[model samples]
Structures are given as C-alpha cells and as structure tokens.
Target chain A: MFVTPGYAQETAPAEGELQTEIVHEEGGEAGFPPFDTSTYPSQLLWLAITFGLFYLFLQKVVLPRIGNILEVRRDRIAHDLDQAARNKEEADAAVAAYEQELADARTKAHAIAQAAQDAAKADAEAERKSVEADLEQKLVEAERRIAIVREAAMKDVGTIAEDTAGAIVEALIDRKPDDAAIAAAVSQVR
Target chain B: MAEDPIHQFQISRLIPIEIGGLDFSFTNSSLFMVATVVTTGAFLYLTTSSRGLVPSRTQSVSEMSYEFVANMLRDATGPQGMRFFPLVFSLFMFILVANMFGMVPYFFTVTSHLIVTFALAMVVMLTLVGYGLKTHGARFFKLFVPHGVPGVLVPLVASIEVISFLSRPISLSVRLFANMLAGHITLKVFAGFVTTLSGLGAFGVIGAVLPLLLTIAITGLEFLVSFLQAYVFAVLTCMYLNDAVHPDH
Candidate 1:
C-alpha cells in the first residue's frame, strides 16, 4: 500500500507548533500512527540516534571481526593448498630419484655381467694356451721315445735278416753263411 | 466492549520533556527502539565474542545474518556497495528485531509506525542524495533523465522520473509500515472477535472458533512478514544506493 497524498497535503500546512498539538492529542485519537502529524520529529531524532550508534558498533566491532574471520579462513585454506602442492611435488621428485637410482642399479648390474663374461673369456683363453703347450710337450716326448724304440727294433731286424740268409744258403747249397761274410754280402748288395 | 485494536498503536509520553516548545518526550516507541538496539548489540557481541573456525550454533546464526545482508548488497550494488554495509546491516537488524518484538505479547513494534519507518527511509534517501551529489556532483541529477529517451518526451519523462525518484522514501516507508500495520491490525481484529464472541453464550463459544483459527494463522504469517519486510527495506535501500553510486541508465 502507498502513503496517502491527502495526509501529506493536510500535514503540509500544519508545520511547527500545530504539528505537535495535533500529535499529542492528549487523548491520542483519530489518526493512525502512519498519518499522525506530531510524532515525526522525535521519532526521527531517536531513529537517527539509535541507527547512528548501531552503525558505529557495526563498523567498529562486528563487521571487522566477521571480515577478519573470513579472511583468516581463506588464508588458511590457501596456505593448506600451497603446502599440499609442495608436498606433491616433493613426492614426485622422490619417485623420480628412486626410478633413476633403480635404472642406475640395473645398468651397473649389466656392466658387472659384461665384465664377468670378458674375464671368463680371458681365463678360458689362457687355460687353452697352457693346455695346448702341455699337450705339445707330451707329444714331443712320445715322438722321441718312438724314435729310440724303432732304432732298437731296426738293429734286431738286421741280425735276424743275416740268420735268415745263412739258413736259406744252407738249404739250397748245404752250407751256412758267417756273420762277417753276411755283413760283407749285405754291404755289396747296398 | 473489547479493547480497541488501534489502542495498541497510541503513543504515550512516559517522561514528558519539552525543549524549545517541541515535544521530545520519552515514549513507549523510544523504549522499544532502545530495546531493539540493545538486543541486536547483545546478540552480535555474545555470538562473536569468541571466534572459532568451527562456529557455535549462535555464531552460525550471526554469521548467516551477516552473509545475508552482505550478499544482497553485493548482488544489487556490486563490491562498491560494501562501504554502506554498516548502515544496511543496522537497518535490517533494527527493523527485523522491532517487527519480531511486536509479535511478542503486548510489545510495541517500532517498525509498525510510519514515523519510525519514514525516518529510516529518509535516512536512506538522504544518504543517496548526499553521496550522489558528493560523488557524482551535479551529474547526480542525470538519474532523472533516462538514456535513449526521445528529446521530444525528455521533459515529460524527466518530470515523471523525478516524481518517482522522490517517492522512494514514501513507498519504502509505507511498504513496510503498511505490511506490519495491516497484518497486525488483521490479527488484532480476529483476536478481538474471539473476545467479543466468547461473551455471548454457548453459541458465542462456537462462533469464536473460526476467528481463533484465523488469528492463529495470521500470527504465523505476520512472523514471516516481519522478516520479509526487513529484507525488503534493506534490499530497497541497497538498490537506491546503487542508483546513487552508478546513476547512468
């Protein structure tokens, strides 16, 4: 609902003292509080006073505390988020380091395996050379023994051949050949 | 006869004082106004005395009230409106408390009076004018002229604009005053019917039931209107202020 213009028109002329007399109708009758002409000034004065005091209190005490609380809460949340991000980065770095160290260990193991293989190959090569040298020495010794035995056998064969020649002559001409004669004969044949 | 429903609104001079032939008497209205201020102060002070990250129930309520007004101001007037947060908040608290106080048995509602609400509306309007003039200088009158209005209709539109702009105080004051007045008057009327009917015999007792139920319903509705009116007053104040702050279109 709206304020009646008639009330405004009526109160427009009754400015100063008449307003008060009308408001304090000793009996306080005939008008609604909305249309009452007299109580305007004091009510406005008190309202001004009351609201002014309230404003001061709100500005000074209440609003600042609320603003401060909200600010503190916001800062706390932001700081927590920052700390969380830093921790996450640190964790990621630590994982990367672990991965790097693991890769290095794998590489080192490969290098150890490669070095062991090379060392085994060298050992096998040296053993092969020594074994070959020892075998060659034994073969040389065996060949010398064979040569000595063959010479002995060859002497025996020469004696047997003379005997065989004597026996054959005895059978064919009823005579035996002597060792010296045989030797002379063998030399002539040579 | 039942008590006059309008009798409750009559202003009584408690400590009659006259200064310079003016009636500046201490009154029933004054008593309730002081009570509203005191109650509002006590609530804020007590609820917020000890700050906690996890708030108490009272603290939550206090904070909600703060956020409610703060958000309204921000939504209507932008961050620039924060400067008047104290005024807006105080107006809301005072009106809300006073209206709620009127709901209590036999308590006077300061907001129900036209003089009180008009005083508040004038403060808001005057602040708008004062700050508009101060901040925008003479350009503040540009509010009376709409952008894109035809030059031929400019004077007519401007005059209409000026009238409506001036009526801000009346509409603002009367809106709250009327809601409270009408709601309370309806409530009183229904309640009076119960008293009047109960006097008549058995038939009267039977007739009182309907008015009693209506009275109960209106009382509950008045409680809701009390909070709503306070909200409207504060929101309208913010809008008027926003106009002052940015009086372009």
Candidate 2:
C-alpha cells in the first residue's frame, strides 16, 4: 500500500490546485473501494449466496459423484484381487488332488508287483523240494543193490576156500579138514 | 478523456433493490459471482457426468483439482481434514475463478474487495473455531499455549500465540485483498500511462510502447498471481483448520 501522493489530469486549470483537488476527489476522500463499508452487506449477501450454493452443490452432487467413481474403482480392484486369490487356491487344491491320486496309483501298482514276486518265490521253492525228493529215492535204490553184491561175494569166498583146503590136505599128508573147521578159519580171516 | 483508473472500481447499482435500508441491489460483483458459480458448476457437472474409467481431458482437470485440494487438506490436518474438503475445495475454486475472471477487461474482481475476502477469511476462522470447540471441547484453547515453554515465559509466549491466532483472519483476508488490489491498480495505472504518453504526438508514441509492453507483462504476472493467491488462501485455511483438528500446541 504505497499511496502515490496525487497527480491531476482532469478538472484542473493549474498544476498545484489540480493536484490538491485530485487527491480530494479520488485519491484520498474516495478511500479504498474495498474498504468502503456501505457496500459490505450486499457483497457479503451475494458471497453468502454464492458460497453457500457452491458448498451445498459440491457436498450434495459434485464431490459425491467423484468420490463414488473413485470408490467404485477401488472396490473393483479389491474384488479382482479376491477373485484371483480364490482361483489360485482352487488351482492349488486341484494340483494337490492330482498328486494324491498319482501317489495312490503308485502304491497300488507296487502292491500288485509285490504279490507277483512273492508268488514266483513260492513256486521256485516247491520245484526245488520235489527235485531233492527224487534224488534221495534214487540213492536209496543204488545202496540196496551194492549190499546184495557183497553178500554173494562172501558166500563164493567160503566155497573156494573149502575146495582148496580139501585138495591141499590130500596132497600133503593124506588128510582133509572137516567143513566146520574150514568155515571157522575162513570167518576168522574175513 | 482523462482516464480515471479509480472509476473502474466504482460499484454502480445494476438493479437497485433496497430492503429496509439494506442495499442488496444486484451489483456487478454479484453478477460475476453468479457467473463464477454457474461456470464452475456447469464445467464440473459436464466433465464428471460420464464418470469414465479413463477420464476425458476436462474430467482429468476437474479430478486433478479435486485431488490437489484433498491432498493439501489431508497433508495439513491428516485424514480428519477430509470432512472439510467441500469447504476448502469451494473456497479454492471460487477465489481462483473470481481472480482469473477479474483479469478480463471490464470485469469486476470480487476477491480484490476487502469485504468479500474478509467474509471468506471469517468463514474459515469461524469454521475453525466452531469445529475446534465441537471436536476438542475446551481443549482447543491449548493451541495458544506453547508446548515446551519454560514456566517463566509461558504467559508471554501464550499472549503472543493468542494474538497471532486472532490475527489469522485479518492477515489472511488482507494478504489476498492487497495483492489483488495492487495488481489491478498497477495494471490500470500503466494502461492509463500508455494512453497519456501516446497523446504527445510522434515522440510520445515511442514512449507509449514501453508501458504497453510492461502492461502486457504485468497482465501475465497478474494471471499467475490469480492462481497463486487462491492456492495460498486455501493452504492457509487448511493450516488453520489443522490447528483446530489437532489443537496440540
């Protein structure tokens, strides 16, 4: 607020008097137009009307519309996120179910294979037992045959020794050994 | 004709209507005020009426302004300040339009008037007081007391703070009024200079060019001032309201 003293361009005949009157008419006496109190009520009233209507309009219509748009956008974003999470969870559950089914199938396949392996082992054991039984029967028959041959050889040896002893007695001293004596001597030698 | 720059500010009655000694005659200021409101209202309404997901240009501008003031309020007073968004937003838009509208040749600058701006400042101050009292009860008085003041200095500091607090409306109103008044008066004085200088024949035309260019430059500056003053007024209102909301020294 620098008050520029005064200058005159109108309603003057001389510079000094015109300057004073200019100050008197417009510069000083007129006051700052804004500070003029008489116009306060009307300006204030209009301001009140304008500002009040504006505030109400904003609060009631304009702001709410903008706010609603923003809010709707935010809610949409949140909803999309929630839906994506739900989809992810469902996918995870589906993967879990698929893995569980695979595991069950593997267990069942293993059980079936194990049963086949056990049956094969049992069949091999039975075949080995039968073969052992047949070999034992054959060994028993051969041992019996050898025992018969030994008995025949023992009877022949007794007969041959009796004949030789009779010949030797006739030739040496005109005497022959009896059957019971020969049998006793051969038995002692065997 | 001697150009009287002061005559431009004269408040002539356009439609004189006196009610019980009250001069509520519809004046030029009132006309511009209505124009500001209607223009603001219509622009906002048309732009936002679509509410498109991807905003149009006008919608973008409106939304930017809305968010700008909203953020300022929120920054100053926290989330609690959002309740006063309509108040702050309207003041900002109203003053901004009024100031800018005044820059037009032969238009009334409503914000340039002391009575108008003072009323606005009073609205801000009274709203602060009313809300402060309502929200904090008697604790709002704590704003006048400095938090870390020594016991000996408390009274002095408190008195100063109280005076500062009380002067908010005066300073707030005057700061805007003075700036607007000065800018307009300077512009008019220069405009008058251009005419007066050109009246002195060929040599005077050469002299008149400088004031003409300067007036253009100042006109641009006034445009900026128009926006800056509105921004400052709104920011100060936010700060004062912050004190009311928090009221902590």
Candidate 3:
C-alpha cells in the first residue's frame, strides 16, 4: 500500500538513471518477498483484518472500560439525585406533619382553655347563688327573733303602766286598793 | 517520444543556475510544490483566522477535514492516537494536493514519483517503530508472539511477523505512486497513438477517433483513481498509526 507512482515501470523513463523498478520474484526468496504486481491487492482483505482487529479492541477492551465507567458514574449520579430528592420530600413531609400536629395541639389547647374558662364561670355563679341563699336565711331568722323580743318587751311595758296608773288613783282618792282592780291589772299584766 | 524517456520527464528550466556543483534548476515541479504550500498556508490561515461560533463556508470545510481525520485517528487508534492528528492531517492535505496537481495541464505530480512516496512511507514506518518503542520500550518486540501460541511455533510466527512488519513501507509507497504513474502513462501512450495515426490521410481520422475516446475514458478513470489513492493512503496511515499506539492485543 505504500508504493509511490513515480517508480512505476510504465512511468519510469526507458533510459532514466533513477533506480525505479518493481521486482516480483515468484520463488520465495531469501530476502523479503516483493509484493504481487500482476493483481491488485484486495482492499477487502486489509479492510477485513483492520475492522476485525478494531472490533476486537472495541468489544474487548477500550469500549467496555469506557462504557463501564460511564454506566457506573451515571447510576451513581442518578442514585444520588434520587436520594436527594427523596430526602427533600421526606423533610418537607415531616415539616408539614409537624406543622399539622402543632396546629392540632394548639387547637386542643385553645378548646381546653375555653372549656376551663366556662367551668370556672359556672362554678363561680353556683357559689354566688349558694352564698346569697345562706345570707337571706340568716337575715330572716334575725328579723323573726327581733320581732319576738320586741313583742315581749311591749307587753311588760303595758303591765307596768297599768299598775302605776292604779297606784296613782288610790293615793289621790285616800282609799285602799280594790281586789277587782288589782286582779284586772294582774290579768292585764298576765 | 524522446530517444531517452528520462529527458521527457524534465520540465523546461525557468532560470539556468549552477551552485556548488549542484544543478539548482527551478523546474515546473518545484514551482507547483511552492504554490501548493503557499496556497494551502494562505487558505488555512484565511479560513481559520476568524473562526467564529458560526463558521464561514471555507472555515467549515477546513474544520470538517480536521474533524474527519481526528475522528478517524481516534476510532482507529483510540484516544491515544489523537496526538498524531496534525501529522496525519498534513499528510492527507499534502498528498491530495500533489495528486491533484498532476492532473493539471502543465504540473508535475511529485507523489507520482518513487522518491516522494518512499520518503512519506519511510516517515510512517519510522514513526511506527519510534512510537512503538516509546510506548512499550523493549517489550514492543513481543508483538510478534501471540500469547496463546504454542512454543514450538514461535520461530515460524516470529519470522512471518517480521516480514510483514518490514514490508509496510514498501507496500505503502508502491500502492500510491504505481497507480498514478500507470494511469498517466497509459493515457499518454494512447494519446500518442491517436495523434500519430491522425498524421496520416483520411482513413487515419477514423483510426484516431478510437484512441481519443479511450484516452478520454482513461482520463476520467485517472480522476477517480486520484481520489481513491488519497483515501487509501490516509486509511493505511491510520492503521499503521494504530499499531504504534497499541501493539498488544
């Protein structure tokens, strides 16, 4: 394949001093055998050998190694990205869940606070009614006792006044006291 | 045809100059090579100077060529082969330019010569050896011996591998130069035949017509061969460069 056209038998001058010759020795000689000049070298032959060897390298060594590196790197990168996305989603979900729990807890706390406030208000109202009832009963009893005392005192005063009136009448007339008047006064006193 | 065919290969000298026992004559071939270099340099520089995010048409083509070889190298020799991208790309450009240059009316095809193609092949061969050694050191020799081969067959296998290795430069250079030279010479010979026959009278015209048609067909075929030759050269270089990068299985 490396032959130059300048030295071809046809183009070489008949008397040209240039050492241009194509030597084809049929008998396999001692030195390197000259290439076959009668027939053109089959391009397919060299092409096949070249392609075969090339394919071998590709299939066996160069491509496999490169492909492996790329495949592994791709898988690793993809896995890392997937893991990151998953972690982000999980974090987001956790935050959402925590926020939801906090809101629920806050709502429960608010309800509890409202419920406690209502209970306290009801308890206070009941205590106020019961204490008012107690105070009213004491006031009525005191008033009844005071009325009784006052009526007794008033009766005594009436008796004393009648007795005195009788004494005064007897003295002024210079006569002894009468039993009917004394009995009437005593019955009045009783 | 000249009595000496070698004399026909020489393009007329532009300026006759002798320097220090050397025939430092400027020939048409030298002019084209210079033109090629200048043209290529100017083209790449102009196209790539303002390499924008959105490329110009020329810039796009240049980048495509770069990427084409870059991808080929990477595919053939793995990522390790990317370092040789410049060499391979330059080679592809130079050889393609040289090959196409030959198709012009008054230009010489440097690649159609043995010395040029041999030098290119030698570079590739030397590079292959140098890189293999650099990469693998003394262990590079172990490429000849497959691991699973029986010990008894070691000698046979080693010999075959060495012959194959040594033949790389020879095959690489011959394939390119031979195809171009053969096609061109055949066209020239047919053209000569046509013109020679037409120099005769009326019946000669009919005889000349056939050779003219054949020459036309051959010219078209040569054009196709030029592209094919360039492709083959580039592809083979890729394979050899592959060997350099990775010698083992």
TM-score of each: 0.82, 0.71, 0.54
**Candidate 1 C-alpha lDDT tens digits along A1-190:** 1112222223454366335644554545545555676776667767777778888998899989977776787798899999999999999999999999999999999999999999999999999999999999999999999999999997777777777877887788787756699867765664
Docking class of 3: incorrect
- Where model 2 places Cα greater than 4 Å from the true spot, the runs are A1-31, A77-190
B241: Cα error in model 3, Å: 1.2
lDDT of 2 by residue, B1-249 (tens): 246666456564567888889999878778888889989988888899999877889998888899899999999999988899999999999999999988987777888888899999999999999999999998999998868889999899989998999899999999999999889889989999999999999999999999999999999999999999999999999999999899984
Residue-level error in angstroms, candidate 3, position B156: 1.3
Window of ten residues with lowest summed lDDT in model 1 chain A: A1-10
lDDT values, one for every candidate: 0.83, 0.85, 0.66
User: lDDT (0-100) at residue B7 of candidate 1?
Assistant: 48
Compared with the true structure, model 1 gives a TM-score of 0.82
Q: Which ten residues in a row have the lowest lDDT in candidate 2 chain B?
A: B1-10
Q: How good is chain A of candidate 1, measured by TM-score?
A: 0.70
User: Candidate 1, which segments miss by more than 4 Å at Cα?
Assistant: A1-31, A136-144, A147-155, A164-174, A178-190, B1-3, B192-216
Q: Quote the lDDT for A35 in model 2.
A: 64
User: Which number leads on lDDT?
Assistant: 2
Identify the runs in model 3 with alpha carbons over 4 angstroms from their true place: A1-190, B2-8, B11-26
